[model samples]
Every structure is written in structure tokens, then in C-alpha cells.
Target: MDNLQRIDYLLHTNALDEMGKNELISILLDEYGSKIVRLAYIYVKDQGKAEDIAQEVFLKCYEKLDQYRQEASIETWLSKIAINICRDYLRSGWFKYFARGVIDTFPYLKHKETPELKLIEQMENEKLMQAVFSLPQKYREVIILHYYMEYSTKQIGDLLAIKSVSVRSRLARAREKLQKKLETGEGS
Candidate 1:
């Protein structure tokens, strides 16, 4: 069944008490935790903040489970909430002042990964990461979702509530900017 169907069924059939809530939380976190944090990181670039935002997103989802109307896919709703939270974090003065320099954050951890593969995987150059991080929010979002997370334009559109055409256009523009920056060895 689709996530929307599963979510609707769960909401309608499950107990909403602490044990039930924890079970629901486990299910959601298992499905969405890393993806949600990665989505948040595309905006904030701070691992700690991304993780905090992910936690807040799940907490909000659990709290609002009883009220969810099943109008959209659960993933879509979670992505929207996470995107909004990340925006709030970006717009806050504290983020600009105290957290801007905190960008040397850890990449997302894969619990199943061997340390050998972790060490063997080629990392993005500092210049590349800087170029990506300097992009406007929309461009950054599309780039991360499309390139890093390997989401299709249609998937990105669904997650971002934009048309796939818009997602593709934004992605093209973002690619152009990244190429120009890479060619010049600086951010465009």
C-alpha cells in the first residue's frame, strides 16, 4: 500500500496512547529519519540543526497524527513541515550570527556502513561543497534533492509542491551556475 494509505489506516486503527505513539514514531522514524534530516540539511547546512529539525518534524507529526486529514502523502506532509522548519531556522538571527561558521558538520551517518567504505568513498571538494552551499534556497533544494538524494524531478516536485517542469528548470539553472562557479574556481 502507499504511504498515504498506510498512514490513514494507522491513524484510524491504532491506539493513540504512549505505546501506540511510540510504535508509530518508530515506524515513521525508520522510514523518514535520515531523509528528513538530509532535506533539512539542504537548507541549514548544519548537521546539528538538521538533526534537531528532523526530531522536531517527527515530534510534530506524532502530535498531529490524530488530526492529519490524509489529503496528501505522509512523506509529502513531512517534507513540507521539514522545509518550513528549515526556513525558520535559516531566517533566524541566531543562525546567521552564531551558526554560520558551524558548517564543518559531519555528513549523515549510515548505521550499516563499514568504516572501510566510509574512508574509501571520495568526498566532495571544499570548493564544490562551498559552491553548493552558497546557492539560493530553491536552487540548493533542487540540487540536493536531485543530485545528492537521487530524487527524480517529479519526486522533487511532489516533495516541494512545485511542478516537475519548474523543478527541471530550476535544476538546469542550478547546474549552469555550478558549472560556471567550478570553471572559475569560485562561487558565481
Candidate 2:
């Protein structure tokens, strides 16, 4: 069974013992941890803080698993939770005066290639990430979700709790800003 199906079965069967929790959390973190960190990084820009946010996302998920309505896919639900946590961090006072520059962009977590191929992929990813990190958070997130995460505008809207039209407008503006930055070599 899929993770969601397994989770649902566990909850329904009242089999949420230690083994079950471990298995569920393992599957979840294995499946979504890097995505959560990367998504959070799009907001906070600090890889360390993004990793913390990812852990918090999963913690909150486990706490609230019983309340999951399944209106969205498990990945979507986890992403929404991650987005909210990252947004909260961005709005917090700690991030205002203490924000650090982007230290490291999240590395791709899934490994499906030879060592040489992975190295080449990481090298390519590094160049693009520099430009992406320079964007304003509002524009950055829309760009990240659309291009990096490959979420549809409607899916992004749902995850961010915004209208799809708003997502499209933000994406348009982000693309314009990104192009200008790439051309000028400055985050204008």
C-alpha cells in the first residue's frame, strides 16, 4: 500500500504502535524530507533553518494525522504544512534582523544515477540556485514552486492558500524579475 493508505489503515486499525509510527515516519521523511527543506528554503533562504522547518513540518503532520481530511494528496497536505511553517518563520522577528544570506541550497535528495552523473547534476543545480536565492521571497516562492518543485499553479494556490489567479500573476512577475536578474547579473 501507499504511504497514505498505510497511514490510514494504521489509524483505522488503532495500530499506531512504535513500529507503525517508525515505519510511517520513515516513509514520510524518505519521501518528502528534501522537498520540504527545499520548499522551506525558498522562503527562509537559510538551509539550516529550512531543515528545521522541514522537521517541524513532519512533527506537526504526525501530531495532526488524525485530523487529516484527505481533501488533498498526502504530499500536498505535507507541503501546505511546510509552507505555513516557513511563512511563519519568515514573518517572525528572528528572521527580520538575524536573517542570514543563503548558505546552501538544498541538494537533490533522490539518487537515481551514477556518481559521475550526480556530480554533474549537482554542478548544474548550483549555478541556477544562486540566481533563485537572490529573488524577493514573494517572487522566489512562486518561482520555486512552479519551476523547481513542478507544482501546477492551481496546486501552488491550494498549498499556499491563495487564489490560482494570484499564483499566475506572482509567477509572471517573478519570471520577469528573474530574467532581468539573469541578464543584468544583479537582483534588480
Please tell me which predicted candidate would have the highest TM-score against the true structure.
1
> Against the hidden true structure, what lDDT does model 1 obtain?
0.76
Q: Please list all clashing residue pairs in model 1, or write none if there are none.
A: none
- Candidate 2 lDDT over residue span 4-115, tens digit each: 6776676567666677767777888987888788777667655667889999999998888768777877789999999888888878877665443221232332232444
Per-model TM-score, in order, reads 0.76, 0.72
* Model 2 worst lDDT run, 10 consecutive residues: 101-110
- Give the distance in Å from residue 59's predicted Cα in candidate 2 to where it truly belongs: 1.0
Q: What C-alpha lDDT do the candidate models reach, one value each? A: 0.76, 0.75
Model 1 spans > 4 angstroms off:
1-8, 12-19, 101-123
Name the top lDDT candidate: 1
lDDT of 1 by residue, 1-188 (tens): 76545555666785678877777778788888888987776676556778899999999998887776667667777887898898888889987776654433533432224432232234566568678877888998898778777888887898788999999999999999999889888862
Off by over 4 Å in 2: 2-22, 101-131
Candidate 1 to truth, TM: 0.76
> For candidate 2, what's the RMSD?
6.0
